[model samples]
Target: MVRANRRLLRARYGRYEGGPDPLAAPVDLTEALDAIGEDVMAGSSPERAMREFLRRGGSDRAGLDDLARRVAERRRDLTRKHNLDGTLQQVKELLEKAVLAERKQLARDTEMDDGDRMLAEMQLDALPASPAAAVSELGAYDWKSSEARADFEKIKDLLGREMLDQRFAGMKDALENATDEDRAAITEMMTDLNALLDAHTRGEDTPEQFDEFMRKHGDYFPDNPTTIDELLDSLARRAAAAQRMRNSMSQEQRDELDALAQQAFGSPELMQSLSQLDGTLRALRPGENWGGSEQMDGEQGLGLGDGTGVFQDIAELDALSDQLSQSYEGSRMDDLDLDALSRQLGDEAAVDARTLQQLEKALRDSGTLKRGSDGQLKLTPKAMRQLGKALLRDVASRMSGRQGNRDLRQAGAAGERSGATREWAFGDTEAWDVTRTITNALTRTAGEGGDTTAGIRIEIGDVEVQETEARTQACVALLVDTSFSMAMDGRWVPMKRTALALHSLITSRFRGDDLQLIAFGRHAEVMDIEQLTGLDAQYDKGTNLHHALLLANRHFRKHPNAQPVLLVVTDGEPTSHLEASGDVFFSYPPHPVTVAVAVRELDNSMRLGAQTTFFRLGEDPGLARFIDSMAKRVGGTVVAPELDDLGAAVVSSYLSSRRSGGSGGAGEDFDGMFGRGWGRWG
Candidate 1:
């Protein structure tokens, strides 16, 4: 993959000029909105819902759930790798068996002097009970078993490398294989690296100085950083990890490792150069973690003598790097290893982090949601439209469960064509009825075909408007209950969806008609589709059906020449009434004044020839009884609907009403809607 990317870059730039990691792609609107809807329906506030939306790691690669599993796996891996209890037992058994074998071998060496044999026995007897102590003492002793000696030698090598390698990668390899010449070369690299850091710190370093340093010692760092700052950043992280490792180890372990680190390259000067480099890096990158603690699950047998320091360092670096670049914003995010992230954090979590970062980037790039002047993320107009369209599509899908092509001619302006061609009219909003209009134009043009009719064309007389069956335009008011109780019952999103669906249908399909939305709770207010969808459900002191009905009446009055259609969606009865002065009077146990006020408003609507339908939700007896009684008084339709089917029910009814030419009026069996609900709601 690296080779391919390199080739691609070379082709693009004429050289291998690498760049940063690409930001994540945008999440699908359907998925994002569905998650948002779920959170909102679960009673989260809009702000909380947005937070939840962002929290899910917007990518398909992983999520919070995946990350949690990875964290567990990491913990288990640490425990398994550093199992000090089991390792200590193994070391003790090996030590005892080796000592016994050595004593037996001494007895078989018959040519040995008696004094030498006694001395050998004394050395074997001197072996301590503690494995750590015995191993420490065995440095000068001759071992009977080469295997045991080899094992002990491996322990020393492991301990030595663990101490040095925490501060620097490949230190173990260098220590095991580096010759005197190589050690000298490492010392030179360290000295130059520190010099560069110091020069850079003093603001005396130039690109030339960086180039010179890299030219001389670039082989030390395989990442091949292009800039001085990049190299420093790389060094700083490792240096910090080493310091943290020192901090996490026991004092005794620290002391032992301090001695062991010196033996790494077999040169004191190499260690000293490294020591100076560490100081310079630390001073330059003070922001790195220098004081942090981690719980050692056991005596982690990282190195032979005191590998605890190395294990602790590894753990700390894992934690630090996990936070710094795990699909999050970073100065050099491309340096991250995503596969390693999945191994450490779990694939699910990795995917989540990746996707979340992508979502943020997508949001920023798309400009759909933005930080406003107040520094708060606010949805842009484009975002709102997209969200509304997404919601409309969902509602449309639900309504399409059973369908045929809808004849929208009833929704068009009413007229009967005399089967003639004419110029376009000012009020023709419907699509051109192509058959008759085109046929008429062609018939006229064919006879006029020559005489400035060089083309088979008629002039303005060629255009015509298609006529429709006569039907009056309807003035529709959709009143939605936006009370706290609606949210509590998980009916708020459905209500909003229904309103958006019906709004879209009317505005898009029946543009000649007047459509208004009124939201009623403790008070009532007029809201457009956008405002209504964003409206938060709060303050349940009242369900102001009176104010809502009054608004509907006002709409009817504005369109007195048209049919008046009213649709009310509610989960509760009116618990508040309007005062004569217009302040709301709220109560709980069915206030007579509130009910009267509400009923009187409905009567006014009825007087205006408004046809009403009450879509009731929930099973509260008081609500059911009151809505039933109210529907009866106003002679409106009553339909108690499942929340999921509310949009389909309402939309179908509106279409049916238009088709029936306002047939289900006062005293009509509105319950006979599509021959299904007249009995159910009645």
Candidate 2:
């Protein structure tokens, strides 16, 4: 039986090195735009609103605040969980083992002279209690046991590796059990490095010199720096972190390490070289935070080099925290350092920040936002249409759910085209009767018998437009309460959203309808869709329904030939009314005069034969009673929808009123609406 041997396959997993993770989900621009629109409608500037959305992030992506919080946590963990005494502890252990081995060897040697053995024991016992002193005193002592002598020499090797590692990262592991030749090579490299730094400081160093230096000692630096500035940046950051670690150490620890550091490689040469390098780095890169310190009070011990690395990490975290705050002048999403963030917090964080950057850029470049003539960021007309559509969709969804899947968008009559054509006049938007127009042009050209080579000269008189039988149109007045109570009770945004939804519907679908947005805060004013959507929350304490009703009546009077429809949305009774002198009279409790004035206006609207609807918000007993009474008096419908359903309720009521005939109008068939301010845009 021939059996084949099986081979095992393995896979390695590391950090993804591509520009961005393909697996990372893209930012939802719609969700972001909706959030920004809400804030914009709530009185925030477009730029401020966009910034807030990015800072808050979305349901699936981490935001700036979350990343900043994580950075703080990571920094706290670094400082709270470590102390800098690894090398000192290691040196003390080696010293103890060496002394014990020497004592055991002395006791085992039977042929040694009594006086010589006593002398050796006295010298060992007489050594200072300090690890550094003990190691230094043992330098001249002769040892009989190879094990004891090796342990004694190991202390020197440990100090040498640590000292080198402190100056140049990775030296500790790379120079394990280093030979004299290796030490000589390090010393040579340090000399050359110091010479290069001195020349650079004097402004005499050339790029060639920098290239030569790297070529000679490039392996010492793991970060492959191509320019002198890059090299300095790398070295300065590490060197500054090392200084901070020293500053953080207690005075006693500093003294112990100082003594121990001098004995590195059984000499003081390495420490001297390192001290010179630190000085040069600090001098050349004075912007480094060389005086900073941290308190490390935990159980885990870190050597000098590792402590420096942690300090560097803390510095990077600080930078990320600042970048995420975005509170500084000229601060922007692109200011965030993704590379440093990834190194400190992981690739996921970098991806999140990058996504936010892309989102902000897209919003700005998508023509959704623009800078006004005043140099302030504002939403563009396109943004208004987009926001309106989103709100309309939301309203439709709620209406569908509430009304059992009924179509929310009721189609308005666009009228049938009359089988006759007339000459097109300026400002006429009616579709051109193409066949009639061509026939007119052909007849005119034939009658004139003009040049036959060139294209037929069709004058303005030859253009004939097709006329349509006028459809009955409705004049809608959406009176929304913008009083302080609305803002306090969280009805401000909902009311604005309702207005925008209805406006969008009338302007986009029912182009023949005239919709007026009247907001009654301390006073009533006629607002366009853009004005109402971006209206700031009012703190004035008055719901001027009387003034709003007056405006509605005037709007109905203006469109005398169209059907009148009045919709009033309010959360309170009439607390204020407009006096004959045009002054506002406001009171907390329902003023009798104010209620009388509002009632009189409602009666006037009823006489005008407007189809009316009262959308009462909140559960205040007085408000419900007042709204029911008003609706009953005018024979109008009353709807009490939740705040979330306000938009749907208003939009549905508008559509319902259009379907039902008004109390009075010119006729069922509208006339002269084709070229007479039909669409909102016109």
Candidate 3:
């Protein structure tokens, strides 16, 4: 019963007998959908896959839509099959909330941690007391809340202190007579002494009585000490003891201490105190001394007069404000009001509101955008992909058309069968004559259905077959003009699109053919078909057709019998080349040298049994004259096709050449290039 059903299916849908099985053969859609689904699951979208499909000459929208639907369905089915839907959704939501919480906590932690750590440490040291009293005892100032007048008075009192002048005088004398090594040693001692004094004033000293002694006599210290090494040794001992005390605290204990200290002294008053101390320390330098007979004006002399001091005081405030603004900017993802964007793009535009909305949702879902406190929009990698997809769609749409005369083939070799029968081979396709084999066996068995005899003959007539020889061979080189002039006429993009389409055609349709891409501006370089989509014309000196043709010839040299052909797409004539002295020579108005060089390259190509075709953009009479001359000289063809006809022209030219036994025949007919009986509207 199964065998009968199988025969019936074969009779209904199978291919021709002794030929390829049409139903069993792989369809392009199955392959494309497989690839598209792979990309989609790897975080691509239907629109993106569709755009890529179109760019690769899968230009039928209905067909692509079907493939997209299949891909989506496949993705959904796979998600269900692997039991990943609910798990993925849960994971996504959990990760999203966790990430958002993390970001918020990080910002709060960072802002609260800066400069507050010092005040917090101070508060911790002075525990078991009110924070305000501890801060006052530590000389903490509230610069923001204090009257400007009070700050000015404090600045005056600090500048007029007698200790600063004495220190300056001692430092000036020490520096004037010291040798380099003595100066270096004294400088090192002063640095250590200053650090020690700072640590003592900050109440961070160990062996508590020594800290008190330093606080009392720190004013007697010199800027540069004669006993430099001794001072450093003393400071190092103190620092080591302090470090040991710090290391004795456990992680949890340290964290608790830090948190408690933060709660106590993380206030405006503590910050002002640190700022005032920093200012006073800065004033201790030699040039900054204001305690002399000068009796400096408190406001003008210290660059702290009138509003200047206020500006200095508020510098950090301004920085904080700026940081807030940047944070708002970075976190805001709602800035692009989708409703407004949809309206702005308009319903009739290439990208509709729904498409934009889908893109925005994709971005949001992908975590590429987040909403800020101010309700502004922030862009993420997801948003970037959306934008990229939109751009790619626009570009691919602009370049869509029925292109090239050659029938685009798949990437692998297609089999062709000969009429003559051969002995059945091991690798032959299974579509061969099974009925003939069984009939021959039956006749040898004298028409018996259950013959078990040993003398059953296997004849040549019952043998199955497959191809044994190479049926098709072709080698093509695509030369693109990447000169600045191509961009001048807005022709570079179209040229790139044409190259991409041709590449897609040859690679996808005629995979057995050898294809090489070479780009030329001021120079020529070999490129790949895959690289054409991203090709941009170079801003160089001038077009050099001679160099490009010579390079193309060299590329095709190894493939001597594969029907070698060159397709040159350029907007201008040759204008540059290397001279005998190896210096670049450029000329306009058809220099004889340049013309001779171009002709010589073409001559060499022809000599090696290769054909060259030129596709010119824009109608320059001079370029036309040169092209006509070249075409006649090489017996090739020149096409000055309009944009719409470009695809047909290319396809027609290639197919015509292919059918003409691989020779450069002029003006071969290509009226049916698109397909047999395919009509062109207007």
Candidate 4:
């Protein structure tokens, strides 16, 4: 063998940082579809079902509600874990250190005048009890220790930076050891910001003015908003959070901070500029929560800048919680801010929310759900087929004696040989006849007079397989009770599932067969599988099996050549009958006329030679006795399976009747096939 060209591939590994993962698997919509389908079958609209599934989430993913809960928990923890008295405490510690160092310096100095030293001691001792008051009173005091003087100046610097930091983020670190130039620049920036806001309020602002202001003070705002609205949103949110932080403090603490504000930067100008900024932000963005307060109970303290940051976090969390709720009017999944969510709750939460959004979009975009002319979301026909196949698989798993029969029985697969041979076609899985194939090859060559002397070469035209008789086509009518009892006793979804499973089997495996879903409450009407699955429960006080049987007989008449297979799922006896006037007459305790009418209709069905089975649902003794009597009257079968097993029981009975060729004479054999302890009552 010739040597093949070889290529060597090298793989490199590194830490994964941000963005979508290239190795991530494609999103799976099966779990979402199943949940949505189940809810739709339970009488919820498609839109409502989709929303409920996203809210409740799946086995492996957190839902919208779970994210909202985490947000709420984070907010609660912030309030419970820290108090806001850090700045004042720092001021007191620094002031105490400065005074202690000065007193020691005064004692160690030998060249100082006696009267002056005494005066200094008296002035230091005369300092006010409050830290803010003491700092303000020492504004003019002379200090001997250089360290003490520097510390005193640092206290003033701390206050000034914190004061600015409350309004603007990162100000504390940015203004450390700030020069006179930094202070003047901050004041100038504030003046420009206020002027810009005032011009915007009067509708006199232009894009050029905003651009010029950002060019001068853009460093102040790390958010770097490009538009006026964006800048206002950011500034207004922080200002409101700061105000809320002040509101959350005790009255005494608020008063102390108010007094301390006058000492920030050793001047009143900074406070005045900040107050103006706050006023302008509140005026421009009036909808921000400016008056809210929270309770803090923990011992850890947060300084002014840090406390405001916490409050801002709380504000973001509140907004996120609302987004997750999806309860506001005109809200959509796209309304959720994934970037902000990722910032607050990490990447996993953002992933969950994004996944939910993608799932909803896929459900609509993939043709699984579509808007009808009626302006309501409805399941498409493709969706119905997929959902029905899923139900059929569930039914198949519950079925017995066919471990290898995973697929529904396809047409022409019933292994009853007709002892004849025919040319094979595509998709034919029947076994080939060895003798027939060789004889056909020889006969073809002899007829052509070309391959008799040489060995007979078998062409595709000479190939043949044994033919099997096709199964009889079935005309099946599935009558499901939609009366108040079926809804009240929790048999609605199972009824729909059974109907869907049977519908799927016939439409998918036996396309030649005819299946009609007939739902009867106070009256009978024919519905397709989609309509039946999404049908809402009714509180009508009637079973109306009389009308249902009347409809079933009419269906059998429509297909006279096909075998009739009738399957009835009900939870009550006949309480209603169709009248000659084309109306329904209903009664409660089994009216004699209603029973007679129902029995008369059953006789009509028997005369038409329909194979019948009754699937009674509840434990009502009267229902059991009536169903048993009815089954005996027509030589049919009665099965009372649990709600979960109802679909399997109904499908198995249908298959048994189908195998019996749908002849009423094969009732004994049909019962024998379904007599596997399937809760037969008659």
Candidate of highest lDDT:
4
* TM-score of model 2 vs. true structure: 0.84
The 10 consecutive residues of candidate 2 with the worst lDDT sum are 673-682
After the best TM-score superposition of candidate 4, give how far the Cα of residue 82 lies from its true spot, in angstroms: 1.9
lDDT of each: 0.65, 0.83, 0.46, 0.85
lDDT digits (tens) for residues 1-682 of candidate 4? 1233232234456746666566767678788877888899999999888888889988898888899888999889999999998898898899999999999999999999999999999999999898878988888889999989989998889999998888888999999999999988988998899899999999999999999999999999998999999999988888898999999999988988888888888879888888988988888888999999999878889889989999999988988988888889767788888888988889889889888887777888999999999988999888888888888888867763333332334324344787877775444567787888888899988998776778899987778878765478788899999999888988889999899889988888767779988999999899988889999989989989889989899999999988888889999998999999999999989899999999998888888878888998988898899999998999888888888888888887777677678544433343343233433422
Give candidate 2's whole-model lDDT: 0.83
How many clashes does the backbone of model 4 have?
Answer: 0
Give me the candidate number with maximum TM-score.
4
Number of the candidate with higher TM-score, 1 or 2: 2
Candidate 3 to truth, TM: 0.38
What lDDT is obtained when candidate 1 is compared to the true structure? 0.65
Instruction: List runs of model 3 lying over 4 Å from the truth.
Output: 1-470, 530-532, 580-583, 663-669, 672-682
lDDT value, residue 208 of candidate 1: 95
What would the TM-score be for candidate 4 when compared with the true structure? 0.87
Off by over 4 Å in 4: 1-24, 400-406, 409-469, 663-682
Report the C-alpha lDDT of model 3 over 139-184, residue by residue, as the tens digit. 4422222232233233222222211221232332233333546534
Model 4: lDDT equals 0.85
